[model samples]
Target: MRTQSHLRIGDQPWVKWSLITLALTLVFLLLLVPLIAIFVQAFSGGVSSYWQNLTDRYTLHAIGLTLFVAALTVPINLVFGVFLAWLVTRFEFPGRKLLITLIDIPFAVSPVVAGLLYLLLYGANGWIGSRLMDQDVQLMFAWPGILMVTVFVTCPFVARELIPLMQQQGREEEEAGVTLGASGWQLFRRVTLPNIQWALLYGVVLTNARAVGEFGAVSVVSGNIRGETNTLPLHVELLYQDYNTVGAFTSASLLAGIALLTLFVKSFVEWRQARQRAALSEDEA
Candidate 1:
């Protein structure tokens, strides 16, 4: 029995690992069940019919418009997220707390309300909308208006990702650069940019995902015009309404595929960044 106990101890496989495996298995089942169902439906239309339906003019137009909007909105959000993160992190201000709270408002606000707020601010009969209309500026229910609402709802992502890191690092590196006679641009380009680039990229990926998949807010402001303001998510809704469940699920599956691709890309990027940081640290030592 003592020899048997010793053998068991020596060859112990592991228990925690089993728990982890079980956890992952459960998670995968939870996600994969619905996804596999959708995939089954998407292809059940047969490869030819699936391709033909997916390539239909309206479907093509919807995909193109959504991609165009995401392309436009993602970059804007990236820049804004980075700049806002830098300002809030690097500077001290009286209303800094208030500013941070305000940035988080979008995260908590119901997306529909966010949509309505934009409408009220930019609609023809609304306050700011009325003034802008008077000045011959158009907004509400326009493409530009749709993108604006998307940005507002997705604004907090990058800033939230960055602030804690900045707080932890403080201003030591940047201050050191300044003390070494580094110019403002040099300090930012050399010191700041390198530090936060990963978080920025990750935020961009997430923000792009959010913007592309956005429904409630975009639905309200977009007017859901086909071949015009109809983004992919809205298009899915339109197809679903027409009793085109296959088409709708096809589009949803496409979005899900994009989301999965983005996540893998983000993970790869973060992995590379981590490896590079590790290499640099090793070299410095």
Candidate 2:
């Protein structure tokens, strides 16, 4: 008996190799080259100069303020993301779709627009500015404004991550827990938390990255006060504007390192998620 031969679609070797070469070239030029350039320029002035630039008082302050903003923003967004995901996924209500759409508005809106909106609302001539001024509360061009815009821009990260995962999980386990007389807090702590923890963490990592790296919106609201409102990105811009190329690149190296570290963590999370899914499949099999 003669066996039928298999035919492969898109089996042109030349086409495959050409596409691979193109992709590699683009990645090298667009990503790897810029990354290496940052380090090369940063150390062009030698270790001492690089160290001095990094340890300058203003640079230290900028780093500290960036960390502070990330610390404050991540937790708030994490809680809000989880709560919003749970609310929308586990309940049916009027305007539920609209609420979810609104939550996503930030993602659709430009970061610059997000900052400008806050400025319009809180600037001295803005609607509530006079009221806040009467109370001696500072918003625009202050830490509060920076914090507010950071929160607004990063709001969608966790919620976007959790919403689909929670929806796919459905309410079966939760319902079972409730039927077993578990309190709301008990159900969440025991039944729900474990299921969503990985996704929650993934979201937190993303939120932290964006919070620290955010430039556009924060720049608009921060007033770019050196050693004060100057986040790391803003600090880099200030350094570059002052013709301190080495200083700017040095400051930028820190952010690049952060981006690299975040990429590493994200890869690990994705690997673990894949492993978890494979293990579940094996058990079912």
lDDT of 1 by residue, 1-285 (tens): 455456643254566677678889988899878888887887878888678778988889888877888888888877787788788888999998888888889999999999999998889989899999999987767788888888888889888877776675578889999999999889989998888778778788888899889999999998877888888899888988999888888888889899889989899878966775687578668
Give the worst 10-residue stretch by lDDT in candidate 2. 1-10
Q: Candidate 1 at residue 187, lDDT?
A: 92
- Model 2 — TM-score against the truth? 0.95
Cα deviation of 59, candidate 2, in Å:
0.4
The reply for model 1, stretches above 4 Å from the true place, is 1-29, 273-285
What C-alpha lDDT, on a 0 to 100 scale, does residue 229 get in candidate 2?
Answer: 88
Error of 1 at 162 (Å): 1.5
Cα lDDT of all candidates, in order? Answer: 0.84, 0.91
CA lDDT of 121 in candidate 2?
A: 86
**For candidate 2, lDDT tens digit of each residue in 12-112?**
66778888999999999999999999999999999999999999999999999999999999999998999999999999999999999999898899999
